[model samples]
Target: MTDTFKHRGLRQKLVETVKAKGIQSEPVLKALGKIPRHLFMDSGFLDHAYQDKAFPIAADQTISQPYTVAFQTELLEIKKGDKVLEIGTGSGYQTAVLCELGARVYSIERQQELFKKTSKFLPKLGYRAKKLIFGDGYKGLPEEAPFDSIIVTAGAPFVPKALLKQLKIGGRIVIPVGDDVQTMTLIIRKGQKEFEKHDYGEFRFVPLLEDKN
Candidate 1:
């Protein structure tokens, strides 16, 4: 939980790198710079933590590149106090970012090991989600229906209906859909049964598992 001047400097550089790559959301950039990405990674790979690339974390998942996190977050168009649902809580980095942006985050992680580790680690880093659940992301948090925004961090073959249904009308969902090279898709709930879809670009991510096996 030690964020030294060096860490802060690296984060500032990381922010500039992400900004140069076209992430214009000031809030998102600020959150990115504020979070200590190295704390979310293994000490052995600490040097690579702020390099704007995804690195392996526990449960065979990657922490996600800073740019991707920023891109998905910006697509959500988060507002202060917005209720956000995060489908994957891998390193809790994105959770920290959303929390930094003043969103109430409800995060789910299917891998018990990563879930347990992150659940304990996040609070130590002073980033707390509104609720951290251990369950299948595909089913989503139906009891906490109608989120202001939902973000799926993994690549799914198709959009989960449960996630779409759990969003508030006019809420937005940012998910990567595809088995191989996933397309970053943004879906806005226009009405009870109407939604608008926008595709950003391609990205490669680990598969989104189901059933909490």
Candidate 2:
């Protein structure tokens, strides 16, 4: 694909833009540069792709802003080959970033239309995940328990405990918790009975809807 102003801007302005907002991870900046944010948003909003704003995608969900994506990814403290679980695959933009960072992304989406569409879209764009499930992400993926990391794209009333169970020891999970407005949070499973929590601050996100077939 031919590189455009938007694409180049994403790589160029990422550190400056995210640093201004308190995102402090070189790895995240590099990943953001690699992932094409323009492909995730609507054509009308493509010009605004690297401007650090969320843009609407299919299923009435918005692809998160660059800083938010970088902030969440940074909190995970990812390493190469980490087994990652992503709860909501809205637009698969975040998923692409995770995969680009060398995480084995296992993403689940409740929206049938969104999941089905992204299944094709992700591979076509060259950001393939370890797995993609169309069922409710609230329950987490039991069969694939013990993931090295987990990320929830949508906001929930509280951090889902079931997801905690699936997290491997010494792993992290980034989730947005609250109602109306949410706190982007990171949870780390230190051990069998120990864990750590960090709040990345507030964000506006669509509710994590429970979907069943």
Candidate 3:
């Protein structure tokens, strides 16, 4: 619960590190700077909190690397008050960034342990999403579909068709599609049945598990 001046300084440095890597979105960078990432992890890992890398968290999930979070969030081009769907609420770090940007975030986490922990933890830090459900990320959140944007935090072997159908016309999804390694993919909805796709190089992430709920 303590975010000291030292921690703030470290976060600013981390922000600059992410910026140096080509993350130019001011709003996204500002949100990253504001959130206390160290507080999201256990105190034992406090020393590594502000570094530009992911670290293990509960339930074997890693809080995403800061650069990866920034890259995906920047690609989404989040606008204030946009309805954003986040798949994989691991550590609630990405969800906090979305909240800081004023997006109405609906996040789904399949791991019950992480879900319960995060559901209770996020509000304590004042990063409250619109909803946090313990369910299969593969299914997306159809009941609350037509999101302005969707972000999948884990690697998927292929883009789930259900997620593609959940976007509003002109909306976009930023997902990493692959197996052991992933190709960051961005798909933008053009019309009722049209989508524009782009890939942004390679990265690794925990696999997005399906149907284990």
TM-score for each predicted model, relative to the true structure: 0.98, 0.93, 0.99
Per-residue lDDT of 30-56 in model 1, one digit per residue for the tens? 999998899999999989988989999
Candidate 3 residue-wise lDDT, 1-213, digit = tens: 998999999999999999999999999999999999998898899999999999999988999999999999999999999999999999999999999999999999989999999999999999889999998988999999889999999999999999999999999999999999999999999999999999999999999998775
Worst 10 residues of 2 by lDDT: 1-10
Error of 1 at 102 (Å): 0.4
Error of 3 at 153 (Å): 0.2
Count the clashes in each prediction: 0, 0, 0
After superposition of all CA atoms, the RMSD between model 2 and the true structure is: 1.6
TM-score of 3: 0.99
The global Cα lDDT (0 to 1) of model 3 is 0.96
Candidate order by lDDT, highest to lowest? Answer: 3, 1, 2
Off by over 4 Å in 1: none
Stretches of candidate 3 off by over 4 Å are none
Clashing pairs in 2: none
Q: What's the distance in Å from true for residue 27, model 3? A: 0.4
Clashes of 1: 0
Off by over 4 Å in 2: none
Give per-residue lDDT, candidate 1, residue 122.
94
lDDT of model 2 at residue 213? 50
- TM-score of model 2 relative to the true fold? 0.93
